[model samples]
Target: MSMVGNPVQVGRRPLDVDLIDRARAGDDHAFASLLGPIVASGYRLAGAMLHDRYAAEDVVQEASLKAWRSLRQLRAGAEMRPWFLGIVANECRSVRRTRWWSVLKFPDVESPAMPPDDPHTTFAELRRGIRRLRHRRRLMLVLHWYLDLPMAEIAVITRSSEDAVKSEVSRAMRQLRGLIGVEDA
Candidate 1:
């Protein structure tokens, strides 16, 4: 059964539960099936965090492998998206730690093109502002704003309290507004 494009309903769907069980039992296809829908989200999160397509791909690969190995540990009724995303976040953090020096180099050719338009320019500026934030703050902002994840889920992924996540997101937004030269009104 195809898992891609399927709604994430954890134990509510018999097929999803079956796939999870088979995946936990070491069925590689089942594992791949379960990951199909959410993997693109993982890639997007990694790309936003790392700011490099190739590095993001590497991070997603590492995270996917980790999820595969730890599939059995996942609770039956729990949502898989947040748990898997947390792994991706951890992998991104590890990559950032190891490749801290790489940030000094010129931008990658694969960087998204920012068209010379009012909205696009503003978005590009905002992206630049986001890249300037501390990594943890950036991750929190991207998870909440870019990925549309809930604050509680972000807290779980970052191992911070929900209040902490809320504060960090607020601080990041204020910093971003300053960087983009937008005055609070």
Candidate 2:
């Protein structure tokens, strides 16, 4: 369980269901096993939201700890991935609110694997536009678009109505397009 590679193999085990259940019952190993698979996904989501490697790592770590501590409070039928993501998202917000991580914005130390170079300025503009969005709306858009999550699941993680998620996503998209100067085609 390196938590940094091979998502397929890491989370492929059917034991996750059992592990989640046991972890919810206070088993530490079960909790560790439960978190191993989705940790990378959590990192990816947090990384996208924060756009900083170290900050994303911090968010993931904090979210994992919180999820573990509160695992027992989760509903029985709820899936772990979204639960974990929600925690990570919250951690990202906490880190951003502190504003100490803004030092990561300099290009020299930033991760180079951002969006593709095609349409050259698209990614840069998109990043800027994303930053312009209110924090909650930005998270919703990133979780929906980058993570490819449906509105229903995003609603679950964001703790908002599906309609609200839909509206936020819609507004975010509209704002992005407006910023990019692209009219409906």
Candidate 3:
């Protein structure tokens, strides 16, 4: 998938492969290019996990730096999205562990900007229900549903087996249903 006009191609390789090759050869532009598509997803993941946009931005920035420094460790032919998300997850966990006090001190600046529609109510309730879930379950739900990743990739990002990821997603959904007061059919 070459960018339009630029037409960067490395002998029929995929765009990511070409970018990875260039990045690994000390090309900073290629590294940024590789991260371009997935950066929004990474930010969304961080915001979901951290529940604070400022902190989430910081976590993503830190994760990007780590990804850049450790680009050599990324396996060939691997999907960069999940790999980068895993780093974001790890960074979120680290921030949570070390900066617990920040949660109390930091005020959430962004309110839920619901549109003038009835579905906004349901969306707010769902967000609240998701927030009430246990951290691991919430992370799994965000990764599976929000990020739309497969169970195997979720397992890799969360550092668990595929079976465990499946079970967590199931349990999380059930818990969310319960929290939202929706009876199981």
Instruction: Kindly give the stretch of ten consecutive residues in candidate 2 with the minimal lDDT sum.
Output: 3-12
What are the candidates' C-alpha RMSDs? 4.9, 6.9, 5.6
Better of 1 and 3 by TM-score: 1
Poorly placed runs, candidate 3 (over 4 Å): 1-13, 16-18, 101-118
> Where does candidate 2 clash, by residue pair?
none
Question: Please, what is the TM-score per model?
Answer: 0.81, 0.78, 0.78
Ranking by TM-score: 1, 3, 2
Choose 1 or 2, whichever is better by lDDT: 1
* Lowest summed lDDT window (length 10), candidate 1: 5-14
Candidate 2 residue-wise lDDT at 150: 81
- For all candidates in order, the CA lDDT equals 0.81, 0.76, 0.81
Clashes per candidate, residues 3 or more apart or on different chains: 0, 0, 0
The order of the candidates by lDDT, greatest first, is 1, 3, 2
lDDT of 3 by residue, 14-123 (tens): 45466776898989999988788788989999999878899899999999999999998877656677788989988987887785634566432445666645686667
Judge candidate 2 at residue 95 and give its lDDT.
Answer: 86
Give the clashing residue pairs of candidate 1, or none.
none
Model 3 TM-score? Answer: 0.78
Q: After superposition, how far is residue 184 of candidate 1 from its true place, in Å?
A: 2.0
On lDDT, the leading prediction is 1
